[model samples]
Every structure is written in structure tokens, then in C-alpha cells.
Target: MNQQLIAFLAYLSPSLFVITALTSWYQAGLRPTAVKKLGMISSFFGILSSLILAYAVYQQDLIEISTFSIYGLGLSLRLDTVSMLMFSMIAILSFVIMRYSLNYLDGDHRQGTFLGRLAATIVSVQFLVLSGNLAVLLASWILTSLCLHRLLVFYKKRPGAIIAAKKKSIVARLADISLLIGFVLLYQIFGTGNLEIIFQNVREGISPLLATATIFIALAALLKSAQFPTHGWLLEVMETPTPVSSLLHAGLLNAGPFLIIRLAFIMEATSTASTLLIILGAFTAIYGSVVYLTQTSIKTALGYSSIAHMGFSLMVCGLGVYPAAMLHLIAHSFYKAHSFLSSGSVIDLIRAAKVTGAKRIGNPFKIILGILLAIAMYSSFAYLWGVDIQNEFQLFVIGGIIVLGLSRLFSFALDSNASIKLWFQALVLSAVVALAFFSLESIFHFFLMGNVPELTIPSLSEVILMSTVLTLFGLVVFIQIFSPILNQKSSFQALAVHIRNGLYINVVFDRIVRAHYHKEDSNSRIVLEEAEIGKYILDSKENNNEEQEERLA
Candidate 1:
């Protein structure tokens, strides 16, 4: 990939998406087939370009398209390893989602409008990832949220959709303001908004101003990622079409982690921001994972699952393991998109059986066996990779989490006779999984070696935070595996109620939204209904009067 070719592809890629969006919006008269065809063509080209860029564009292949060069203080689009990685992920997922929508929304009235908004959302995300200018990045951030809001309210008549969209808008605006504050602080600290300049200027001993900016930036990431207290909107947004849900869960929600990764220099430099991310991100992960198990709806459960995944990703970032966090996100996006799109098939498969609520009666001995095996497997991989607790504590802790989660699979091995063969088979499977996991981790780390910060030993506080998070994750796993026994307890049942309601945070949000916006919605509907009734009465009276006069004559 030469410079001219790389530049051409970069320009062509974004142009394709933008052109498709404008044409779709222009032909918003429900020309579903044409819109679908256009979307496919553009996405195909986009995927190709992005894939090429991902492979060819490296750390030094920095390309910038500046709007204007006025004292080196203008907005520009950037193309580097980070941006290229994001470009590849989003482009590939966008293609999958658009292709799915063509069939999912066949012959729908507003399909064109939905596809148009979807394309626009894609465009916003592309610019956001490619932005070298922090100002342009923030603007793209705002645009992404606005476009997604429009998609959320595609079914305008649904009250749930309207309310969800409203809450999302409110939260998104606050996040935007928080990020804007951070951006202003950055300009003050470095005297420039150009990201390359800022990165070049950042040092180990950052100033008070830069540290303060990290807190605000971290806050914005939390809000944008749909962390707890504001995560209800994500669960309640099932009123949109499935394709919309797929994109929202898979791509758009990743903006938060992406933001943190983009500002890794500052974020990892400050203990305050890192602590905030670890504590809250880990808490939300637990909260969401618990709530996810309690939900009856598949989509709602998946929504909560996304919350958990994003929380964990941010937590990993907080640990200063940027490569692992990035890998987690990319893998999760693919898994979640597939999970959502195939959700209906789950119902179909189970509908044939007259099934009741089945419980997992776990064997304590087996669970313990699985845990030991998981630990051994993780240790084996860690040793092979030359990763130790002293130097790469972050990866070590992350591997612990992975193995802990993997232990749950042992509960489903289905061997009632306590056979050795089953245990051997499970052990083999764990090794394979561990091998694949470390291989991908190594690749991502290679690509991101110079792009992100190097791993360092944690402080006491950071060590405690990691231990607490690990304990919480272990507790979650225990509860899941022992639910049959745990459910029998009164205290367990009580906790379930609270967790199911999201600890009532969303209830407070609902009250606030209803108090402010419910009246306008009700008044307009009432007024329209009253006008229709009045017109009907007037027509009836005129007909009656004419009939009586004709009879008299």
C-alpha cells in the first residue's frame, strides 16, 4: 500500500458511506429495496478499504487530512494504527448489520429512514475514530449520539421508544459537556488541540491540570458506555428494530472504551482517573451480570450482558492493559451481534419442548475440580507466554478472570457416572481455549506495543482494587453455579428483587422523565382525540337535520 493508494482508499471509504447515507435520506419514501442495495454496495467497498488500511497502515503511516493549516491549530482527520483498527471493526460490523436489516425489515414503511440513520451513525463513528483534532472528535461524538437517538425512536408511536430516546438524549448531552470540559482543559494544558502534539507533550509526571482533565474524561466515558444508574435506557430500548439493537449493542456502545484508549496517555498517567474507572467499571460489571441473569426477555438480558462486557472492558483499561481491553471489545462485539441476531432462533428451538424452569443441580466435587483445572490451565499458558505477576500483573489478573469464567463450563459436562474420560476431555478443551486466547492476545499486544502504554507494577491501592474485583467476579460465578441452593435462602430472594429492578435507579430516572415530558405527550394526544370526536359529532348533527327537513317537505 503506497501513500497515494492508502490516501485514496481512506478518502474513498468514508465517501462511500457518506454518499450512501445522503442518497438514502434523499429517497426516504420507503424505497426499501433500493436503499438496501445501496447500503450493501457501499458497505462492501468500505469493508475492503478498511481491511487494507488495517494491514498496511502502521504506527508511522500517519495520515492526516486537515481542513486548514492556520498556525497548526486546525481540525484534521487522522489515520494510524488505532484509527485503522476501529475502522476495520466498525466497517465489518456495519456490513453485517446492514445486510441483516434488509431481511429483518422487509417491506417496512420506514426501512429507508432507518437505514439512512444507520449509515449516518456509521459515518459519525468513522470520523470519531479518525479525528486527530480533539474538537472534531467531540463534534463527531455528539453527532454519533444524535444519529443513534433518531434510530432509537424509529417507531415514534411507541411510548417506550420515546422515553428511552429522551433519557438517552439527556445522558448523551451531559456526556458531551463533560468531554467538552476535558477538551478545554487539554487545550489549556498543552496550548493545542492537536492530538499528536498532546501525545508528544505528555510525560510521566503530568501537571495538575492534566490530572483534573482525566477525571472529566473518565466520567464522559462512563456515561457514554451506559454504565449503571444510566444503563436502564439500554435495556429499555428494545422497541427499536433488531438490526438497530444489533448495531447499538455491537458498535455504538464501544465509543466509551474507544475514548479511553484514544486518551491512554493521560488516563493511565493519573491514579484518580484510573481508580474511578476500575471501581465503577468493576461495580457496573457485577451489577449488570447479576441483573442479566434475572431478566426474562432475551433482548433485555443481552442488553444487560452488554453493560457487563463494556464495564469489564473499561475495567481492563483501568488496569493499564490496553491491548487486552481492545481485544476483549472486538471479540465481544462479534459475539453480541451474533447473539442478538440469532435470539429468535433460540425460542424456535425450545418451543417444541413442553419445558418448565429447569434447575442446575451442581456437584460440589465437580465444581471444585473444574476450578483447580482452570487454574492449572491458566498457569500453564501464563508460563508459556513468559508473563509473571510482578511485571504483567494486569494480564495475570485478567487471565484469572477468564479462567474463572471458563470454570462455569464444567457444570454442563453432563457426566453422572463420574467418568475419567469426561474430565480428560474437559482438560484438553481448556488447553485449546487457553492457547487460542494467548495467541490473539500476543498479536494485539504486538500491534499496540508502541501505540499504548507499557505495563507497570500496581500501587497498593491498585492491587486492592484488583483483588476486590476478582472477589466480586468469583462471587458472581458462585451464585450462578449454586443458584439452586442459594435460591432457597430468603436473603438471596430479597437481593434478587432489588437487582432485578436495577436497584431502582432507573425508577428514579423514569419519574424525572415523566414529570417533565409526560404532560406534553398526553396533552397533544388528548387534544387530537377531542378534535376528532368534535368533528364526528358535527357531521352527525348535519345529517340528522337534513333528514328531518326532507321528511317535512
Candidate 2:
């Protein structure tokens, strides 16, 4: 097929899935077993199409098309390595989640609607990623958010789901509005909505106003990614079905960090705007990690972890380490999706084992997994030290400390028989090992060239001494905190509450919104009540009048 036809087919797959879902809904009376099967099939094809598009884009280097015009603005779509990567990932994951959902959401009343929305969402996300210009991106973003809102509240009778959907809708609207404004500002300043042109303009030196507008664009990205203060919607989003959570939190949530990285490449690297992104990214990382440590519910914990991982990706972007960030992003999507899927299985196992009066013990493999993860994580941090001794080392130390503390907390919080505890620990250890090995290798490579930079931390001996001291300090702090919280109800409750409330940050934001919008419409409320009463009264009065008229006649 020609490149244009191939790209068009790839883009249409999601829409085709949606159409198939609707057909299944019609034919199967909304309880369609066929709908689930067909949806999965369509999604599978979508993934295949996306893969083909990825290959085509790789061959072509770049592809662009003017998709449509909206409100007099041209909506363009483009494919590059970044967009193709995201598209392929989304397609693959969406397919998996759809297949999983067949069994997971079996017999659900709104199954057909859910499948349709899921298809639409997948399609919307594909367009959003492929959007070449701000206008296309914003339009697709709004549609994606809308579809997600519908999926979130698929169980409309569930009060929690309803509330969550409302919250998500509000936050999404805020993001959409901010993005629209940013786009308009950009167009005004840059004279085009083309991303390539905007980047060229920025690189050549953009106006202060345009730079500030770009910050607004970043703000929208942050909101979408669930960064601090604006992160409440994501946590509440757990009310959605598990598959939806897997797709949104694990797969699609990376869009924000992806956007930042893309824009970072376009903008002047040393601009204050870029520096602000770095600070925000770092703060998000720290905040998310700390908050995640406090969470109890498995899904909530993963949500916070997602935030932290995204923050880490953003930090890498801040440091102009785009390649590393991309690597991390890919790794995270796979691991996180696997973790969330496995969590559901774990919950089921725990319940079934409980029925048999058997103590559900930790999975032996999980402990090994945790150790491996810890090693990898620490090793990666060490590699960062080779890049910039001072900054990277400090980040590594901070990240290590956070991981250690978090692992301890997880170990303590889990029931003795719970397998997750072992898994968590193994993963942590594995990460540490991996990071350490990579960092050390990088260091060795740097030295072998005999072009080693002056040892900022002194010598190998001093490096060892400093690492040991930091490790000891971290251990001390971990013990101090861990000891007091040892199986205490109050401590556990405090932690659980903090985790449940997501550090009460969402609550605070809620209060601020409520306080400012406190003018209740008493008249409108009463009018509605009175209108109902009047309806009954008027009906009674009309009946009497009719009866009296009949008697008189």
C-alpha cells in the first residue's frame, strides 16, 4: 500500500473498532458476547495496523497530512518516531486490555456501551498522538477525555463511579480549556499551528508572551499526567473498571511527559521555561514517590507510582536526557501494565485462599523479582553519576533513599502470607542492582578512555566512603521510621488515611473550589421542588374541575 493509504488505514482502525462495537451492540442486544469478541478482534487488527505504520514511518522518516478543519483551524496529523512509538504502544495495550476486559467485565449491564467507548477512546488516543499541530492535538485530547469520562462512569448506578466521573470531567475540562488557550496564543505569536513551524520559530527565538504561553501548554500536560496538586483526578479514577485503569494510568498517562519531551526539544534548552519544567518535574518525582509510599490499596499505590515514574521521565527530559527518558517510559509502561493485571489475579487468589482457610503466602518468585529490581534501579542511578557527578549523584541518593523507605513500608504493611510483599521487595532489589551495574559500567567506560574528568567527589576511595555514609544515614532514617510504625493500629490507620485521601491535597483543592463557588441557588432549588408540588396540585385541581363540570352538565 502507498504510505498515505497505509497511514490512513492505521488511523481508521480505532474508528472501525468503534463501529464494530456499535454493530455488535445492535445485533446482540447489548449483552452481545459477540461484541466482546469482535471488539478484541478489531483492536488486534488496530495493533497490527499501527505496527505497519511504525515501519512505514521509519522508512519515510516523516509523514504529515491535513486531516480536517475545525472552527477554521487546520487540523494536521504527523507521524515521527515519538508518535509512532506511542501509537504502537497504545494499540498493543488497548488490544490486551480489551481482551482482558471480556472476562473481567463479563455480564456487566453496560458492557456494550463500555466496549464502544473503549474503542472510541483508543481511536481518540491514536489521533491525539499523531496530531501534527496544536489544534489537532487539542481537539483529539478533548475527545479522548470525553470518552474516558464516559468509560469511567460506565457503572452509572455506582455512586462512587458517578462522583469520580464528575471529578474527572471537571479536571479534563480544565485541561482542555488551558490547552485551547495555549494553542490560540501560540498561533497568534507563531503565525501557524504547525508544530514543526512553531519549533523553528522558538529555536530562532520566541517572544516572551509566546514563551509564557508555552508554559501554559506545559501546565495542561502536567494536569493530564496527574502532577502534584492536580493529581487528584487520577487517584479517584480507580473507581473505573480495572482494565480502564490499566489503560489510562499505565499506558495513556505517559502523554504528558511525552508532550514535555517533544516540546523541550523544540524550545530553547536554556530558557527559563525549560528550567521551570525541570523544577516541576523534580518536585513531581519527589512528591509522587513520598505519597506512593503512604498508599495502601494496591491500585492507588500503582497510581502514585505512575505519577512518580512520569515525574522521573520529566526529570530526565529536564536534564536533556531524552533517549534515557524514552527508554524508561517504555519499560515503565510494560511493567506497570503487568503489575496492574497481576494485582487483579492476586486479589482473586487471596479471596479464594481465604475461603479454604489457607493463609495466602508470599510468592517465592516475587522476592527474587524485588531483589533484581532493586539492583537494577540502584545501578541505573549509579550510571547517572557518570553523566554529572554532583547533580546526578544527589538525585541517585535521594531516589535510593526513597526506594529503601518505600520497600520497608511495603514489607511491613503486607500481611505475612501476602505474595505482593515478596514481589515488591524483589522488584526493588532488582532495580537497585540494575541501576548500580549500569552506572558502574558507564564509569568504567569513562575511565578506560583515560579522559576521566577530575574526580569531583575526590577518588574512588572517597566515592566509596561517601556512598557508605549516605547508605548508613539512609538505613538509620529508614529504621527510625519503620520501628515506630511496627504494626501499630494508629500508625497504620494514619498511613491508610493518608493514602486513601491522597495526602488530602485533593480535599484541599475541593475546599478551595467549594468556598469560591458557595452561592447556592436556593431559589432555583425551591423552584424545582415547588414545580414538582405544583404538578401534583395542578393535576388534582384539573380533575376536580372536570368532575364539577360533568356534575353541573
Q: Worst 10-residue stretch by lDDT in candidate 2?
A: 447-456
Per-residue lDDT of 418-500 in model 1, one digit per residue for the tens? 46666567667877888877998899889887778889899887888898889888888877766666788999999999988
What tens-digit string does per-residue lDDT give for candidate 2 at 126-170? 788788888778888888888888788876545457656666677
What TM-score does candidate 1 reach?
0.89
**Candidate 1: regions farther than 4 A off:** 1-4, 32-34, 59-61, 70-73, 353-363, 411-429, 513-516, 521-553
Which ten-residue region of model 1 has the weakest summed lDDT? 409-418
